[model samples]
Target chain A: MLRSWRWAAVAAGVAALVSLPTLAGALPTRSSDVTAEELRDLVRASGAVAHEAYGESRVDLPLPDVDALGDVPELLGSTTRTRTAWRTPLDWRVDRLTVAGETDVVRAGALTTTWDSADRSVTRLLGDLPVRLPRADDLTAPVLARRLVATPDTVLSRLPERRVAGRSAPGLRVAPADPAQTLVESVDVWVEPGSGLPLRVEVRADGQRNPVVTAVVLDLELGDPGARRTAFDPPPGSTETTTQAPDVAAEVDRLVPFLLPNVLAGDGRADPAGLGTGGVAVYDRGFEAYAVVPLDRDLGGDLLELAPPGGVFATPLVTVLVGRVERTAYVLVGTVPEQVLRDALTALRRDPPPFVGDR
Target chain B: MILTELAKLVRRPRTWVLVALLCALPTVVAVFVAVQEIAPRPGTGPAFLSAVLDSGTLFPAAALAIVLPLFLPVAVAVVAGESVAGEAQAGTLRYLLLRPVGRTRLLVAKLVSTLAFTLLSVSFVALTAYAVGVALFGSAEVSSVSGTEFSTADATVRIVLTVLYVGWSMLGVASVALFLSTLTDSPLVAALGAVGVLVASTLLVTLEAAAAVQPYLPTRYWLAFIDLYRDPVLTRDLLRGVGLQAVYIGVFLAAAWANFTTKDVTS
Candidate 1:
């Protein structure tokens, strides 16, 4: 009987030992000697390395109900789980997992392949998409880190070591040097010490209790998946279609009648996405930056007229403004204060910047 | 003694009935999907069901998903819950103990038999689903969820891994039921008690308010086997699920042994 009791104790002890390492990792560890500048450089260099990761990204941005937007609103307002094999921004694959099935968007060289599991079809699009909505790809740790650092006046500081993605990664905090310029409170990033990869990122918009966005790498490997792995090899019984995507920059530059200002409010015009195209423009040098879309006069006007909550929809973290300035109707969206959007709309309606526009 | 217990379990009519019920569900679903020629829109129904029509190779995976949430766990709970309790209720356990079978050995035999039942039931369901799927839709091309074609051999490997994962998860349920079986002579009460834990775990797992304790819940990573179909098989959740189930199996089996070996044998 006593031996049986000892056996029970032994079993319980083994269970405790199994849990000990995970519990110990939660305890605060010593901070690394890396500086903020060095971490920034590391993150930038990490972008050049070929690697793959699987992670879950969460966005708490509340989207307004709009008929014109289809599913874009729901897509931006929920958690996105993905597995990525990235060689470069132009050549990568993101497999989005959902309860229904997996949809893979693979970019090989100049063509992007979207494989739909339901239809058993592959659609390949040619050329880079000049301007696109935020996607699962944009919410990953490394991609988000690079975007955060692109903000002109962000100040970086060293933070204590934190465990993420099953590894101890040193932390770096990035905030705007001038607080009044952006809506972002701070961006916290944890880096893989060896590869310099950003393993986790948490973004807190101003005045929000919870981080507005969080993207963390749950599993990672630091080697190229190779060209063969990156290539789109459609299996048997799968239908394939290839379509040429119109050059958005050239089309927008040639078609639109009006112009977006070179600068809006106190912020300068900078397109971090490099969408230097004419009709589509993103303003501001900070996180408070707003995007300007030159919609066709009739569709833009009708959408602005039908927008709910009095032709302006606002979430705690994001704001959208739509208004008509004569024949050229515009939709302005940003994370800045509502006043900034109004001012940008007013500027679009009023004095237009002549920064290299032919029209 | 373990072999005897397993033979006794295999001889029971209830075991075959449970296995039949588990397989019937996926067969019925495959029939409807085949006859209608309309699979659930991507991301609407069970995980792999949407793609099963596209590639019948996913049928076993889809079948696992169909029964995993409720049927398999309930079946495991019922058999394990009846293991020791049924013997006690029938007044055979005390006599068997008197016949010189060690208390710890009896408990070990009972646990092994329950594990065998889990394995038997899960594999039977997979085998049935594979036949139904291949016959109805045909497995000319085996495509993974990530749009890559898996060789027939590779597909079989994934199905095998899924079977092992589902079996391991069912073992967690069996341990809970077996522990309850040792606590009471009433088989029904033991089975109900085991199932109650699963029901509560499932309910709490889906509740956002229960987030703090969700990770520790038994069913937290139950469906993680679906991650195996991913292009580069995601093993993080699989490893965690295995570890969590191991902890549950360890703690509960120890408790059952501690109680059974020392408890008064009034029956």
Candidate 2:
């Protein structure tokens, strides 16, 4: 009898362990888990404003069960160890607007990017791309939307079987490839059966239940896919202006006079010590007079991006924009001349940043 | 004579055992924490400490909570119930009473000794927990769920205050046990009876019908320890815990003294 009781206890423990994954798999799914065509149809039915340009698309991603890499010391003198990582779900909002089907992308707010379909080029219209946004920082909806569309492929997976919004559906669990360093781990989006529309989205992380972002389509409008093509047009008053070729020697000379005067007059340093370091480096990337004034911090990064051609005169520092391109934004700091600044910008636009190739 | 008797009482084998147990508690807890740290699935040390504090504080406030309704009161009862009744059961009470010392003085010394041991034990637990936590997790800033972090200095102060508050919470249990001890000649009977009261209170606290009565229960003050960890500190809860403990201590001591002086000791 005692032996049978012991066996029963062991069996119960084993059964419990085996059933945990099944229990976890029993979570809800969203309408987006259905076919892409069905989802498009549901969106069309939802009475979403047709052809009305919405620059910012806010997508709330609910990820449950984010896998976090566990801290395990490397074994046998190796610097890597195999360990089960910590996993948690995450609540994420992506605010980027997709301009229908022109292959053109525009991200507004901090770290703006504009894709010019005519030139078949992507432009960092504002701030910087691939820049890490600090937690809780307010960013424009478009910027977040781009991030959502550009989510790592490894994080996207096939949907799981579940019920969502009173409908049977499948859900997808999205996670970064490297479980470690994942800010958001598991987001389960449940797609409506047959319609392929997203009905519910749940995010979980670190064994804590996070809030879900759910969207229900009340109406759908599918316009003529071909008739509503968007045409790219530059602003009415914005004119295309071509600048003169760069003169490396003359540009360098202009920069030296301006930089030397400020360095000598300043309080021992070019910028504040704790804030960050700033320096200028000239690269001969096939361009005549390309100058790169790299700011060590983000505060001045935006200033350098938006500085006018003559010079940006912020207190304690000034920078003159030489030229701008899709990837490269060139600036000369101190008392550089207008011609020199224009020349440097032209060179930078032509030559491109050295790290552009790696990116 | 009373002072001499109390001093001699302090040197008794049981008294030294209690002190040694209290002192050794930190080491044992440290070992347990270290083992957990080295385990395959280790919980975050700081998080575990916070959870322990939460459990400790919330449990006493609501009788249905885990700590006060179960573990803490039982621990207090076990220690306090063994005090006078153990002496009586060991045939030492006759010798102790034959002395010129008054019953009230004897009871006072015993109560003081028990209270001292309780405080020492709590302090040892906290110190050991902190030391083990530091050794394993390193001395870093403790971050709360709200994202606000406490520096090492603040964390230390908070931990000390938490432990002291919990000690006062336990005093209520100790008084109940002491009172029960006076009624029983058999140490086991006294200990079991004290523990039984704790178990019954826990059951009563859990019952739906007794839910309204829970606020008045002695175990309700257990969560008062959490007041120490709050940012501005909730002095109201701490004051209430202290006041309730004072009442229990006073009432139980009075009852014990009255019973010892009047009751027959011919067992």
Candidate 3:
């Protein structure tokens, strides 16, 4: 009996060793009895959750070095590990975890505070702007689901259930009704069943076998993390500064910027508030979207110079184009195909969106 | 039996040599850093090297980071690989059995001694680096990776946690080497086998092609100790790292025990 016990222990040890990776994700698919519409509803309701999670967001776009955009290249090219605590959309904290340190961004109401550990500085900005560069939170499953699931022009279906972040999550696939309207082929998302928060999200570009962008919650726990976790206090000796920061640098006279048309390339302005400051305009069709922004001469000129021999930055997932109208450098960037950008640029040059900012 | 094993380990000249070597590396690194005030650029080199230049109180963490990748694990593998096989190779295993110590008890004692050696070596390195650091760079209140400066008390807590975490990580290596020691009569073969596992793990961890198995690899979370310095602290990877090491220790120790007890004592 003792000898048999030793053998039993050995068997159990091997079994445990073998199950580590299997438990991670390699197990057979879990059954899926839920419908696409139900999964979509669950995602929408995930916002009502008050929980915290640790996750990693990864975006791999092979774009050239247009370094002026400030971390744009890195955000689209590498992995970002994030620990997020959310009580509400208005109150949350996202700590970007790095190898040796962390940089924290805390939002309490309309105030956003950024604390940099390496530089020991604190910067406070009032108000959250709608038109800001994409951040780690933007790529997370919940946020991406919120954006991609709201479209009526996509055909939704239930995907096979699978283990995501150790949770048995049901999957949903959103495929565009018209593939030509956008570069996105499909988006697959897996959500936490209890709270309906997305555990993993993958964006697959047209004709691409692998996901162009993927975000996953590696670990998760539900329930309010308390106010202290979401709050921020400037450490003593930190160089603190507050600024009335504009969402985007409106370098040019707002009134002199071009007035974007109500519809361009068969897509209406994405922002319900309409175009602002002639500096930025977004157009969306279904789940497909693109943004046109006018940057300062130096930055725009650099983008123009970096444009490839064809003068258009093109990739499977993202495409960029720069056109000069007299001295203004207009940037056309989107997740749509390059042809859509070409048409937009031609329209801008010929029927040019009139400079209507002049009061 | 355990106390005897501990005494034997403590009395070994080779054990002291390993501890001294581990302690000496950080001293040399600290000297260069102190004199030249040059460290690898932030985020480019090892975890805490760049920050150590600004304040020396953090040198223990920096030292741990320097040895963790290779030096410390190699030292641990040698000691653990020798735990069983060295006895067999020296023709002492038969005598040890005749003394009537149960094979399971002997294995347990050896494991305990190996654990003691790891803690002692790691602690000596940290303590030496602390003295070297405070002497050369002064014990200025250290700034955390998150750009926050806490009291000296907080820094000490973090450094202590780092040492414990590092020692825990080394335990996984020792477990593997000990298991291999049960398989071979040659200490060199056992040590090399353990080192072989380490080399493969380290290589596959950095290779993108090995992404599927990377999470289960033994070396995956060796650096998660860095997470302790974060402002609110990210415990996700830290917990996972510790749990992974525990699984490794459990699986290998059980296998080692089962094999050693039943094997023929031909050596």
Candidate 4:
């Protein structure tokens, strides 16, 4: 009996090792059974739950697992990850740049403080929100699901069920309806069956088996993070800077020297791009989307230093290009290929602009 | 026996010539870059070469990048190929066996000497390139791909890590040549055979039809050393390269020992 038990243990060990990659969480309990419309409603409902909060919540956002050969679209400066833990409607703590660098941000009531560990300086802001535009990591299931479902020319389908964040959740596969508009093939999300909370998100480009991008909750426990209001206060020892967010139009006038002409939306209408709030130009074609942000003069030095001086700064999802035409620094951030960004920038450089000299 | 093997290896004029040739390639590249009127497009060459052209302090890493594919492996192949097979070709195998040197001891000595050559050659190239690069371009802070500046001390640690990772990667090439050296009596044939295997693996990796076999190829993960330049220092591929090299070393050295232990030395 002892010998049999040893053999069984060995078999179990081998089995576990063999299943390591596929065993990201619990195995699938059921096949995809919902229709496309039901899947849409389910995702929408999940998005709602993501917005609702009660107790303290802590979420860890890891960098997407990009393949070595770069088969997926990702973001620039994405080597860093973030952990956001918030106590509903009032107190919060967000640790950003945990992987690439060190930064700590805490928010209580109307006061938000950010501490940059690199220079050991603190910035205090009295604002309605924690940070500008709510960091991508802070945008939980509701925001992301709504954005994805609202995408034009998309094909949605139910996927095989899989356990996500230690709970069994039904999964959905979302892909571009028109394959020609984008290089991205599909995005799959696994959501909690009851709350609609996103448990995991995976993106597959072309036909690759391994995901090009993956953001999944590694662990989750819903309860109080245990912090007094004092935890949100900025440390007294560090130097402080009080600042307000910059004006959008003033930023656009300062940074954008020229704009790409004849830009069109996915619906085949001539919708020339314009600088939106925060000096960002959003471009969308069906399920394909990208954003171009004009950089602040102060931030250019560090961002440009790391990027290839005259070339594209690439991550798995996004490619960023910083270039100067007529001494104005322009940055293009997009989910598009490097070549596309390069071509856009090159075109802008060649076209002689009507000199709306100095705002 | 190990000391004697090392002495014998150092005594060979060809070994010195190979080291000089290995060290010279990067020196020439550095000089050319320093004198060029136009800078090569950034991100065009190896991971850090474009940056190295601007900041001479990073030249050692850039040199490793430029040489890793063909030059470094060729140097390692020649030395490893000659480890055992050169003795057989020169009619010295019989003489060496006539001594009380055990076969395992002899094999171990040869491998150790070859690995020692790899260490010296890689270091020589890195140091020479760095020196030439600094002379040509002024030193500056090391910038990571992830948009961060590293202090001199941090960058030095990374450069050291890069050198060691590249050295570790060459173990795969060295093992292949060592294994080939055992299979043949001609050092040239062994060296060429190893090179041929590497070339074949590189070619196979590019073909879409051969996708199934790419991961298993010895040449598949060599360039993964570039991932070291990233913040958080991408280690997945680096670890894979190191792990694969270890496997190759284990298998090839076992094969070499197994074949050498029972073989009759008639030369």
Candidate 5:
């Protein structure tokens, strides 16, 4: 019995040592307390730094219910491991799930090429650099950092210093400067102090103690990425097709003159004097900017399915207003409320674009 | 020699008229926006036009955009085309060459004067637009199309960078005109030919079938100065544009030198 106890004790000691890094990483380390003013400055400075920093990491996204989400073309599943270099003509790779092995998507410059190892086929999309808004599941850190920079006034609280992806980081909990205007209650980010890059981000919905959406960088590397050649090339024997991005401005321009004038005519909110109307009308109210695009009815596939006829779909960070007016399909996307989007849509319908024929 | 040539170039009535005309475009745009009930959508005409509508102070950028594609390049062409050809047509080239000045030095002086005009014309448009825009619109933080807001100081720096880039890009047009000027004694023909080549390049770049040749077109990256306003300051296109301009300057200037040196100066 004494020998058995000795063996058990030895095994337990070994196990504790193996787990130490993971266990201790979450615990608070040495961190200096920061004032609100300093935090604000840090947020401002974060924008310039965030754009300069580049690395690859394993990312776990918070995906809402798929039935409610519908067909999200840019969706990268709930858990994704992507390698990204965020410079001009950005380069990135996402390991996609497939039966015959992991398919890979690499975007270099303006081309996003995907290699399907299972079928031995490759797909290429030639358009603008593949970029998406910071949602719960997609590019989180940069988006969160951008929001922090844009939000001049925020309620900030310092948290314990923690280690993320082997790097020492400090945490800050931020709430909107005007809580009444926003859907987000608080956003907590673990920032790598040396680089001013967010290592992890957790967004809490209004009145929620637990975060509704969280993104943690499983592995991250900062500084020079060296020569990365593979992320830029498409596989051999793969057919490629180039698709042009929809000219949103031109599409809007084409539809604006034909739009029923004063569809939003009487509303004082549709202030013609200040707001120049395009095919897309963007409303910016600090920390939140949304664009109202009136596309063709056929282009409203996923958006229409996500909401009931002319209904709104409220995601954690984005609220999308979808509806059809005659042959034109209108989609309003932003961080604003469902009502605000709807109001803007109404205003758009009533008013002719600020300058209809001037373009 | 360069300073004297520049003074002589500046003394010409047409140079002042060209500068004044370039300056007037932005004033017209400013007045139209201010007086009209309608305003243009953002990201429409020029890079910063929409922003200028928001804050009249951004008129400098709007003016730069207005002038870069046509007015500025044309003004540059007029001066550059007249550099060698006008003197040759007027029989002053032979007299100038008879002096102790080398043919190379005279050519260099003429080129320098033309470049000086390019810089002055661009600067005049930008400064005039700034004044007019500030008078009417009032200065404010300039918002970039890339969704980044810049402080007035940062915006001013970007505007200066943009002006420099525009001036540099115009060197290609100027060099072409200078080369043409060396070929002909008719300043009008040289100017028209240079402007016509630029127009052709612009037209070719707009065609989808011209994709292979698009990268080599002189006008392909003219408007790429907009990339400087991006959050990270996208340098791929800017660098390419600058490199292209540099190549144009080197080749055309060499051609002008080679032709000018060997040509008979009986005129």
Candidate 6:
């Protein structure tokens, strides 16, 4: 009986040992707490724009050096693949500029200059041009900062203790085992010991010895931890106009077939009939394009409009427009050529508007 | 008494089938994960199980969700409804009730046995899914779509909590089945009636006119199982889910007792 009891006890002890790891693993671990508001403040202090005017910026180009793009085998089947191996051009031209300040203002010029928003439209301004602004909505800086601070506990476990950029930092390195993988090659970030802020970020590409991308802060100011103040004012002599341009479906039909098939395929084929009342016409050299669509009926009367003729074009490129009709506001996007946009407007003759009613 | 009833339940072919079906779900999920792993594509990886779990937990918890309204609740209703009614139909309940067992004790035993079986079914689902997940998708860090990572430890806790939450969710279905079982002589009628209630609640939730009444409906608390996935966690919803389950269980048990005690068992 004594021996049997001892054997039972031994078995129980072994069972407990076997279950320990699983039981421990099933317990939730506390993560470093950081709120979204705190993250927004950190971004502001780092001079990184959190939310800015304009949507996400995209640059699309054909893969450089490749003679012919071929069909690549996917898990499902063969898929057509196009390669564009071009770096972002270092130089860029500004097409239109709008600045928000203590007062609403509008300015237009080839060089840096401030214009009054009172006139409610682009006006030629005298004196030296204002400072050239950086591209809006770039994710590089914000992504780098997020990697530094509040290193999500999920990714923290995979990191090893290491020094980065002369600071004692947690090294959480991720590298895709496969070379063909495009998501990420390797990510290395260094967090400051004192403030938990990321001091340096390095990302290495598949075949590159040196990191293909690196971002480090030149300086940081942890000032008043609060929201930034914003103010808008219109410039002198600027008049708010209610008369929006009428629909131009005929012009859109004439242009889509010639320009679309080369850039976008599949469901991207634009239906010319969808263009409704109120459109803009741009004329450039000889190529012409126009677009018109209904406004969203929700935003009442106020509308913000911007025209960036020199913006990047991805596949299925569409023009964007917003306005209110009958207490409803809508946003319409259409395609226009980079060059010859102005000349296209000259080709269209004035005619009775095409679309009417909310139906 | 409950243990005796539970033992008899385990002997049933249907109970074995439930266990087999529970085991098969993970195997199917594992095969899918293995296929994706062998030939990975953009936005495809081992996290497929997590995505399925995220979506599955909600539908199961909200028994009136699309899937449950159509089929799953009916299946649950059949199992729970037949727990007592089927035995009675087979002439076993009359014999067993005469074997020195009190009426209240028999009802209690039936409810407990049903609850135990349901718990076992849910546990099998959780364990098999986790085992398959670990085998097919290497035990790597779990990354959320929001780019947040969950360590192996955190993932385990989340999975377990999710399982417990789903078990609580099924209690309401079991209770409804028990109540319906007391109402009818035919097990099939009881099962169909329970499923009908579930379907009606689902339809009510979808109607714009009934939108205001949806939150008060017992079915609303079903997807509250997902409260486990919320970072920082919302204890209020979890508590409310449990409270709602308790209410359903109590009401169903009361109705079952009142009806079973008074009804004549001539059939």
Best by TM-score: 1
- B252: Cα error in model 5, Å: 0.6
lDDT of 5 by residue, B1-267 (tens): 888898898788988999999999878888998878245553246656655545776678778878887888888998999999999999999998888998778889988998888888888888888889888888866544333356878888888988899889999999999999999999999999999999999999878568567877899888877766644454656788998888778777867876787788888
Could you give candidate 1's per-residue lDDT for residues B1-267 as a string of tens digits? 999888988898988999999999999999999999988876678878887776677799999999998889988998999989998999988899997789999999988899888999999999999999999988876777777778889899999999999999989899989989999999899999988999999999888679777877899999998878767777877898999999889888878887888788888
Q: Between the candidate structures 2 and 4, which one is better when assessed by TM-score?
A: 4
What lDDT score belongs to each candidate, Candidate 1 first?
A: 0.80, 0.43, 0.82, 0.64, 0.64, 0.43
TM-score of each: 0.89, 0.38, 0.88, 0.57, 0.48, 0.43
Per-residue C-alpha lDDT of model 1 across residues A183-239, encoded as one tens digit per residue: 788999999998889999998888888888888998898899788667778877788
Clashing pairs in 4: A46-A196, A47-A142, A73-A316, A73-A317, A74-A316, A74-A317, A74-A318, A75-A318
Question: What TM-score does structure 2 among the candidates reach?
Answer: 0.38
Candidate 6 lDDT over residue span A205-291, tens digit each: 444565534544322323221221121122223333321111123222232222111112111222323443113222111111223
Minimum summed lDDT over a 10-residue window in model 3 chain A is located at A246-255
Cα lDDT tens digits, model 5, A234-320, are 334334555332233444433454322333422222213223333554555444456666654455555566566557766666677
Please provide, for model 4 over A1-359, each residue's C-alpha lDDT reduced to its tens digit, 9 standing for 90 to 100.
Answer: 64455445545654654465457544567554667667667766542231212111122222233332121112221322444454544566555433223355666678766765434456776764211333433433333455566567788888878876667778888888876546567777777666556666676665456665556654444445556421643333345787554233334434444443445222221235454322344567765565554454655544555556574766555556777645555666555666666666666567623443233
How well does candidate 2 score on lDDT at residue B92?
84
DockQ of all candidate complexes: 0.48, 0.01, 0.48, 0.02, 0.00, 0.01
For model 5, what is the error of residue A74's alpha carbon versus the real structure, in angstroms, after optimal superposition?
17
B45 Cα displacement, candidate 3 (Å): 1.8
Residue A191 of model 2 has an lDDT of 49
The worst-scoring run of ten residues by lDDT in candidate 1 chain B lies at B140-149
Query: Which docking category, incorrect, acceptable, medium or high, applies to candidate 3?
Result: acceptable
What's the best-to-worst order under lDDT?
3, 1, 5, 4, 6, 2
Q: Give per-residue lDDT, candidate 6, residue A54.
A: 11
lDDT of 2 by residue, B41-97 (tens): 212222233232212221111111223334445556766787789778888888888
Model 6 chain B weakest lDDT span, ten residues long? B58-67
In candidate 2, which residue ranges exceed 4 Å CA deviation?
Answer: A1-359, B1-47, B50-75, B144-146
**Ranking of models by TM-score:** 1, 3, 4, 5, 6, 2
Model 6 agreement with the true structure over B1-267: per-residue lDDT tens digits: 888888888888988786666567456645764676432232233223324332232212221222223333555677889877887788777787778988778898988887787777766666665555555554544332212345657656766776676666677888888888877767998888877777788688667468556654666666554444433343545676787677667667766776676566755
